[model samples]
Target: MSPLGRPVSLGGGVANRGQVFRLGAAVRRPVTPHSPATHALLRHLSRAGFDGAPRLLSADDRMEMLSWIPGVAARNPLPGWSLSDASLVSVAVLVRRFHDAVRGFDGGPHHWPRPVPPAYSDGLVGHNDLHPGNIVFDGERAVGLIDFDLAGPSGVVWDLATVARCWCPLVADADLPDGFVQGPERRYDRLVMLLDAYGLNRAGRVAVAESLVDNHDWTYRIVTDAASAGHPGFREYWAGVAARTSRARQWAVDHQAELIKAVRR
Candidate 1:
């Protein structure tokens, strides 16, 4: 039977690129070349006893079906609660759990998506994209991560930096979400809180600090390529956002030292 779909919002690059839908107890999304590897990763996570990721039910040439995780995932112009320090801490804990769960898998024979630079690969697959929109939360507590489209081999510190870059955001004050309290002091405090919650060691923290700039550049390259490919959502999103990303990249560059200092504390 052809699955009936009620369009659902699961924000990020996929949502921007194509349609996603709720089909009874599952989510149906257009498949990409990366879908097969994503499916394998999900199966591995399930076998590894991680319940935070959606289960792959089935797939074909067109769309893939994943078991729906019942929770509120944020969208752009994020809600006030999702921006709270409590949310920050919960997301940190969740990502750490995900990393631990994925630690045993050695990538095996699967072709994964978005392989990070050799400087950041550590043999274990990282979610790679942990932006607020991709995380599922039960109230203020983040319970699961939804999108695995960008998952691939990555270092623990690199993955942590990616998550922090989106969650703590590590962006310039001018680019902060509306209603998100602004100030480097608050950013530092939140960064510290996240690293502490994730239980990162001193050396790991320093590495994450150093990688922020590279991560930012890496992310921008992906989106720019997608937009160039004429993905409607990305094309719409890429409009006029270049300056902000430039500022964000520079922010990471300028503050790398201070961030290292705080995380080492």
Candidate 2:
């Protein structure tokens, strides 16, 4: 059934666990318990007039369909516009709007693929895997967030921290991939810009600074666990990721004071 449709290989991604394909007007992915919740989220976004997310269309036992959002996903040969400060702010705005959209929606009876961390699960759901790969961009602007597979009960700080790590791209210089242009200079300034763009207050900033370190380790664990479980994508990604993960963790720790200062002002 999948082969019959056009394979919409829009570059590559780490969370591409599902064999996604594009049909006439929709994209398809494997069905999961989170499918219903994601579909519900789409409906809410539509009603709220949020155009930054795909709309859920239909589903079956094998695959679920979503409105095919036509845009560029942040990929390896990263688009020049995507790395701009304006693009970063647009993503932050989109994320903030997304959180606002889902703040009051109910997500009961849904078993997320994994358990959300206890500290981050108390109020409001988050797109736990918010990052460039998961986002769709129109030129320099973020248009939508796709892949709600990991969306579940989580707080704004936790989710935003993931965005910071990926968008501000809080990685050590040595860990950055070749051809990738993002660097470590003025990261504190970038962090402040991101937090401000997201409208996070002082307390929220404090929380995000702490979550930045925790989230990095949490993400590496998830990757290793996924790799050990035989997920090909993650396995390939994990081969030489440990050292980078350690370095990212240390970078966060090494700059905690600077991060806090950025948040303060």
Candidate 3:
């Protein structure tokens, strides 16, 4: 089918939905500054039997097409399905399987949306954007990850940190939106649960705890860069998101010791 085919607008994604159009059972979006490496990454996922991500169909100068995954994409503050322990464990299992599968794929040198730190990237790619919105859940279980634009070379800890910060969320209450609700032990419980499911050791726990702090800043820096470059979406997201990230960074730093202690369990 042609790229200009009559298409339906895809919902759920907030930031990078520019020129996204879905046709029949496939979805397509402009490649733009995002590298062709994204196609390679998705192809790798397919070959590795990693079914946690969308299957890449094709890519050209105009757009990339992927097998449209059918499921509900979650939003922040989370929903009933995303909040359950069973769903949490299922998501963790998905991430672990992804890491195991990707370790066997060779990414070579390619342009990624974000760079992975040495401490976080050990020659393997991990989905760095495993947040509520990017995950597709069928009922109460995560079926697959939707956004691969930010997936690149990274270690398991980086992936685990992304999962924890979003699912568990270590940010301050002041940063949360009004009417948001979660249990008190949810943070520690979910984070430790993720750690346990990932089979992390003591050193790995320390590294992951530290990454919770770095990830806070790392996530915001990308936005700041986008805003500076005059990205409309980034500018709007920054107006409120920047402050939350700053506070979240501080929160992560303050709770690092506590997280380490808890993650070690």
- TM agreement with the true structure for every prediction: 0.92, 0.89, 0.91
Candidate 1 structure quality by residue, lDDT tens digits, 1-265? 4455555655455433447777777988888788888888899899989989999998999988899998988766578788888899999999888998988787757787667889988787898887777889999999999878888888788878877787787788887888586565678778888888999888888888889988888877888998899877777777857888888889888988899898888
Q: Which candidate should be chosen as best, given lDDT against the real structure?
A: 1
lDDT of 2 by residue, 93-186 (tens): 9999998888777776566656566876757777888867889888888888888887777889998899888777677877554534646675
Model 2's number of clashes is 0
- In model 3, the runs with Cα more than 4 Å from the true position are 1-6, 175-182
What's the C-alpha lDDT at position 229 in model 1? 93
Q: Whole-model Cα lDDT per candidate? A: 0.82, 0.78, 0.77
Instruction: Report the error of model 2 at residue 217, Å.
Output: 2.2
lDDT of 2 at 231: 88
Clashing pairs in 1: none
* lDDT tens readout by residue for model 3, 1-265: 5554668887655466556777877888777566577778788888888888888788788778888888888777566557777788888887888888787777667777768776678888778888888888898788888788887788788888888888776777675534335655467877888778777788887788878877767777778888889988878878867677777788888878888888777
Model 1 regions lying over 4 Å from their true place: 1-18
Reference-based lDDT, residue 173, model 2: 76
